[model samples]
Target: MPVWLIWFIAALGLAGAEALTGDLFLLMLSGGALAAVGSNLIFDNYVIDGVVFLVVSLLLLVLVRPALRKRFNSGPALPDRAKALEGKNALVLDRVARHEGQVRLDGEVWTARPYNDDDVYEPGDHVAVVHIDGATAVVAKVV
Candidate 1:
């Protein structure tokens, strides 16, 4: 049993663990184990190989891991449900005037009112959701 052979086995085991975990942490440890295999070739000493493995693993965890995680985690920030309805298209299910109306948004009926005081939306008209005011949707006629 050579020291390099032991490190190679450890690297293979750690790589299998990485596949199970799906996190890059174990993969970084596997990289360190591979480094130890290289160190064993140069120094041919188990103690120095173990030291190199520990140092390389820690460096990857502290320095490289955060950057990788941040890059992978970057995505669109989702707005809350209430805010998400803003600017959505809706259909006027009932006559819409400044005082009262009804519209269908996302297949759900919602209380609606014209965005402008004099504006009116007839049934079958397409409208844009301006904002939600309490239980009501402020909407504007598409045309």
Candidate 2:
């Protein structure tokens, strides 16, 4: 039938396909097709409608898609697991020396060591996790 009608149908099809992928690309093409429908209505020329479609689609893909994707994808930033434990109190489960020890942190047992090689903590003493080194917790006496 009319060129505008064909473009309108293509736009509808592209928008429907966009639901399956959820990537916004086909939705951008659908936007272009709608622009083509408008251009065809105004000029009734196939060449002008095609050009309008190309330009609008490329503009949406390059300019709008990234901002939309970023907005959709971004959320609250969470702290790293190791970093979250720093400065938290722990109970010394065994004598904590520079070389080796054990502590209860957040209800879980963790391998621990004193932050200072010269420092030592007896079992039942309170300590704070200074930092994590791999699976081991580097700690300091709480007081």
Candidate 3:
């Protein structure tokens, strides 16, 4: 029945919802609810407590949430399988031509072709994978 108790309960509920959603929005609301509890302690006015909650929540949503989301999302990039193979060195296993060839890439044999139609790779040549087209790796002679 107490205003502070109501605010505290709302804060706890918002925090639990934040846990489930994993987004920063509900967490900001929970911070606002805690601020409302503080306002209730100081002013004992419902209007002041509600105003404090709204202002604090909006400030957090507008300012802190974006920065937190950016920090959370902008971590180091992780490459997928195709991107991971790019620029990796492979050993030519058979005579490679513009349209046809084979290479051993990372201990596994992969179908390969010259990155450029004019290039030719002899067996025992080292090449760098340039890109993947379906199951084939387009490779260029390593230097």
Candidate 4:
């Protein structure tokens, strides 16, 4: 195959692979390959082809990436609600004896305790999920 055809084929292949991997960097490489093919076809000069490919690759990766990602991620099913739950209210179900017990948060049982504080609590106490310290919740009394 011709150099331009080879470069175009490589560009399509790289673009497909980038789509499969879900990474943005390979898209720049695909842009570079396509730019090389086009520039070589237009000018047929080694230095100008290289320069055009470099400029196009950098422009695609830097200027277009954030917009592409924003468009790609724009949807109603965004996972922002999970982040809102931090510092939310919950209720202790078991004795927070020595800073350890189970709590009921939105009807789900979660292991919780006073976060970063040395304190004791009891059942039926209201607490706030201050933070998550791994599998357990670091909660404190909501007063």
Candidate 5:
């Protein structure tokens, strides 16, 4: 019946929903509800309680959360030693001449092409997968 009770219930419900959804964003809203309820409880002043909670929640979501996510959500795009080979190394599995060949890297075979003429390589030659062009891998002799 009280606004404080409403805020607390809403917070608890959102937290439970976050447990089910596993999105992590809803948890921020739940945090806001908790702050609101806590402020209301401590001050018994609804206006100040609501304002403080709102400001806190917004600050947490906009400033704190993005920084935290950048640190914690490192995945394949993370430029670290573990993914070093992604932009380097390829094995020439086919007799390559000019602009067409096959290479093996990234745990799979791929159609390879060269950047220019007069570039030729043979099977078992180590090449560098310079870049990916569409469905093919562009290669250069490793030297």
Candidate 6:
């Protein structure tokens, strides 16, 4: 019946769509529709309410949505398995050179390569895992 009531209903519909999507985009539009309801109640003009809705929606989409998405998406700070192996000592199982080698890390033998192109490790030599590249472990002299 009233313009404000229409806007309120639209806001509720947008919020319902947002629930199904789980994305904040529709929620931002729903916020704009709610603002339109207030504008309609105050000015009682369709054009003014439309303008308010557009401006509020754009503001929320550009500014508020990013912060909200980041806050909700950034979950627990769990440690990465590969990153955990960095700097840990491993025993060279085979001659380790820049091109290829093998090392025992955490009781498991892994394909290895020297971090420095010229560095080489012999069997029984201890080295530190510099980083992991796919299935290979880049290692450096432990000392």
Q: Write the per-residue lDDT of candidate 5 for residues 1-143, one digit (tens) a residue.
A: 88899888988898899899765667787888889998888888889878977887788788777876777687566564324444688888887676578888877887887755578878898888766777677777777
How accurate locally, in lDDT, is each candidate?
0.93, 0.96, 0.95, 0.81, 0.78, 0.96
Candidate 1 C-alpha lDDT tens digits along 23-84: 89998999899999999999998899989999999999999999998988897777777699
Q: Rank the candidates by lDDT, best first.
A: 6, 2, 3, 1, 4, 5
The C-alpha stretches of model 6 lying farther than 4 A from their native spots are 1-23, 37-45, 73-76
- In angstroms, the error of model 2 at 106 is 3.1
Worst 10 residues of 6 by lDDT: 72-81
Give the higher-TM-score candidate: 1 or 5: 1
Best by TM-score: 3
Error of 3 at 139 (Å): 2.7
Tell me which residue pairs clash in candidate 1. none
lDDT of 4 at 10: 83
Model 3 RMSD in angstroms: 3.6
Q: What is the overall TM-score of model 4 with all chains considered together?
A: 0.67
lDDT of 5 at 52: 71
* Rank list by TM-score: 3, 6, 4, 1, 2, 5
Clashes of each: 0, 0, 0, 0, 0, 0
Better of 1 and 3 by TM-score: 3
- Return whichever of 1 and 2 wins on lDDT: 2
| Structure candidate 6, residue pairs in collision | none
Screening candidate 3 with a backbone cut-off below 3 angstroms (N, C-alpha, C), the clashing residue pairs are none
Pick the winner on lDDT between candidates 2 and 3: 2
CA shift of 65, model 1, Å: 1.0
Every model's Cα RMSD, please? 6.1, 4.4, 3.6, 3.5, 4.6, 3.5
